[model samples]
Target: MTERAADGTGVRGRRKRPTMLDVAREAGVALRTVSRVVNEDPTVGSHLVSRVQAAISALDYVPDERARQLRRGVTGTIGAAVRNLTDAHPVLGAIDHNAREAGLTVLAMSTEDEEAREREVVTSMCRRRVDGIIIEPISSNHQYLSAEVESGLPVVAVDRPLSGLEADTVLSDNAAGIGTAFRHLVLHGHRRIAYIGDHERIFTGRERAAAFRACVAAHGGPLDGMVHPGAVEPDRVVAALQTALGGPEPATALIAGNAATSIEVLRHLGAEAGRLAIVGFDDFLLADILRPALTVIAQDDAAIGRTAIELLLARGADPTHPVRTVTLPVTLVPRGSGELPPA
Candidate 1:
């Protein structure tokens, strides 16, 4: 006779799970010997190891990895707190690959770009006793992590730095990339270039917008009605685009601050996009296939990931060392769109 599930969902009852003691009884060996064999102790003789293995196979027994890891005082897992899970996150993939190569598992959780969610996810990771943490910060104040940091938890910030806490960080060179985009547009005979980007409250947004201002000042271009730094919303972006292109001295070219802004600008322009020269910061999926493929300042996603893992491991190996910040370089990928002449 078979037992039905407690909820009467038609799922069959499970067999009595086998335990370590059952394995020992089956092998006719002491419980301690079975424990040693399961733990891979080299001192166990060959004959005993073979007998224990046969018994384990016959009973279909599985060792409790969580209990074993607890006894060893390390979980062999790392936690990654990132912005979202729905997007194509190449950096996260690289981090996972590198962590696996180092014999560690990655427990990834999305923060949904919310400070409260970030705190909840990170706190849960801490409760699980993860060996280290890699975070893409969304919080304006990370002082809540001070206690954990002081207690020797290894934390590495990626893409952006933690606001109030000092930790190892990996970042792309934002200012330099902005400069490259501005110069690229200038080289193509676009003196009246406009800039549209993320909100100034964001770290990258602030850096890129400041860099654009500096470029315009140095080149003697009119700054008025040209630089638009605000929320990346449809209405805001369209208004900014109109202001840049509507005036008598309308911009001949545009530099988009980020990938989302670039897409927004293009979506607003439609078939008219071909008339204006454009350069965007940060590449995105399917960008290369757009008509007049997007020219972009691309961050080195793989390097960012590899370097993040390296920093994480180094932090774990020597928690007393001074915190380090590594800023990787960005590259300019010129496609058809950025090369268009002023309309």
Candidate 2:
């Protein structure tokens, strides 16, 4: 039996385990080259690969999964945290499919737009040691993310900005889309326009709000009565629209912040939908089926998801690379509603 330590611990002191460095030293190659071979990086030459393999066998060294994860600061798994999984957001599906094709597993979680829940979800992913993360941030706590990034983990913000953290991001051009929507309404002689959107704390929401304000001012429209933010839920958006349309001079047209909001606004209008013109940010399934097909500033959600994963994979493989932001353009689809005349 192995002798116990002086402290009366049952376990005896063993020789320190041989690490990748020891293998690299014996293999006569740089630490990075050994890491490349271990990771199956194609850049490693055959001669170095053979040497590393020979050294690993001679030393009888067993690769430590936990140590490897710690050394790379990655778990070979990617995490995606969204607002909801059942929202039928095409982007979620795209993310899952693309990640699988890239030889990376995706662990998706939903925060339901709650800050506390969001924090919990992030913490859980960290505990699992995900290789990287792509998130739709819910709040302005950018400092928390900065700490995570500082820990050598690669993070990318999708559909939003990480308030204060310097990280890679992939998002739609919200300002351009909003500007396009506003201009479309104005071109149709919509002087009284109402904008309904999500909470301002979200990066996309803020950008949409800013663009709406700027466009209204640039087009010489009334910015005061034409702006309405913080109406994300269906019931809230319905109520907001009812109030906006009930005013002394109701809006001639409405601009929805997203597809979900458009659905709510349309439901609120019901049979009166034909009476008011509408332009929305995202395209929905039944948009073309409505009495007057909905006009929308459509974004490629799937592409957004794919691009985000690509960015994360690139960065994860090369931590020393500079962070990048990839912005995809939005297109405005014209339909009967967008061409409606003022009330």
TM-score of each predicted structure versus truth: 0.78, 0.78
Compared with the true structure, the alpha-carbon lDDT of candidate 2 equals: 0.79
Model 1: lDDT to the true structure = 0.85
Q: Deviation in angstroms for 75 in model 2?
A: 9.2
lDDT digits (tens) for residues 66-179 of candidate 1: 333223323367889998998889999999988777766788999998999999999998887776789999999999999988765789999889999999999999989989
Q: Candidate 2 clashing pairs?
A: none
lDDT of each: 0.85, 0.79
Q: Count clashing residue pairs per candidate.
A: 0, 0
Report RMSD for candidate 1.
Answer: 11.2
Q: Residue 100, candidate 1: how far off, in angstroms?
A: 1.6
